[model samples]
Target: MSKKEKFEELLKRLQEISEQLESEDLGLDKAVKLYEEGIKLSKLCHQKLEAAELKINELKSDVTAK
Candidate 1:
């Protein structure tokens, strides 16, 4: 799969985990595991966002240079 596909899958899993955690029936251990996964997902998502921001900044710089 492509990087975009992996990112999208991670995002979907994050959303599912978020919803599951919202439920009161989740066990403590399971919640901890989900929280770890969520932290990983959040970091990956932040990295992607930062990359996109950098790309946008590059494009803006090019536009200004022209």
Candidate 2:
């Protein structure tokens, strides 16, 4: 899958988790599990953004050197 697709999928999952957490009927065990999963997903998204930013910077530098 493309980077864009992966990012979109992660974002969708995060939103779903957010909605699930907001529900008043959720059990503690399930809520805790969702929170943990959300945290991991958040970290993954952050890492992906950082990597993309670094790549963009490198490309810009290369262009400026030409």
For candidate 1, what is the total of clashing residue pairs? Answer: 0
lDDT of 2 at 14: 99
Candidate 1 lDDT by residue in tens digits, 1-66: 326548788889999999998899999999999999999899988877776632333333556656
Clashing pairs in 2: none
lDDT of 2 by residue, 1-66 (tens): 326558889999999999999999999999999999999999989888777743333333556666
Q: Which residue pairs in candidate 1 collide?
A: none
Angstrom error at residue 42, model 2: 0.3
Local distance difference test, each candidate: 0.82, 0.86
Q: What range of 10 consecutive residues in model 2 has the weakest lDDT sum?
A: 53-62
The lDDT, on a scale of 0 to 1, for candidate 2 is: 0.86
TM-score to native of every candidate shown: 0.66, 0.72
Whose lDDT is greatest here? 2
Segments of candidate 2 deviating more than 4 angstroms? 1-5, 53-66
Q: How accurate is candidate 1 locally (lDDT)?
A: 0.82
